[model samples]
Target: KWRGYGVATADFGRADVTWSTQFIGKATDFNADPGDLGYRTPNVFYHNVQFAYDLFEKTRLMVGIDNLFDRKPPFIQSWTDANTDTMTYDLLGRRYYASFRHLF
Candidate 1:
């Protein structure tokens, strides 16, 4: 697994921007060669971006999206059980969310 993050704050406004990325490697799952589906797994990378602005001295609004690239998980045969192994794949593609926070 790998991860990174970056943040930017402007002196003129109460605005903040941030970016982050992460990588998940394929699993080492193994079975007897005879039961192996002959499928290979590949590493996947996910990226996210976020923006926040202060609406008031004590209130801030933030918005962001995860899995910006919308990468799909590798496909595996049914014999392996699950179509795509959740152990090594992220089925959820690009998600967006917003939130507001108040500080005392």
Candidate 2:
């Protein structure tokens, strides 16, 4: 089982500047064979990042991101006619998201 992790930090001695980063990975299994249904990768990755700071000691600002890779499993393999080449049955691409939070 493969496992990993990462972290980043930033310090603002006086003003309030902060930055952070993170990454992780795990390759725990292998398909060996797909048989029929379709081929897939046993390895998957999950990662995210968050940025935050104080606005007025009472209010705070923050942003978060998820699914940095946005990878999807392949539903089909190679073939013609009996299988046919399709732009629809393949894997998905990367996705991005942005978010903000408030405190009460």
Largest lDDT belongs to which candidate?
1
Which digits, one per residue and each the tens of the lDDT, describe model 1 over residues 12-38?
A: 388887777666766433532434653
Global lDDT of each candidate: 0.71, 0.42
Worst 10 residues of 2 by lDDT: 20-29
Instruction: Tell me the deviation in Å of residue 85 in model 2.
Output: 26
Best by TM-score: 1
Off by over 4 Å in 2: 13-45, 73-104
Runs off by more than 4 Å, candidate 1: 1-13, 27-29, 32-38, 77-82
TM-score of each: 0.69, 0.42
Per-residue CA lDDT of candidate 2, range 21-97, in tens?
Answer: 22222221233244554443244454555566665655666555554455453333344433422432223344444
Q: Residue 24, candidate 1: how far off, in angstroms?
A: 1.2
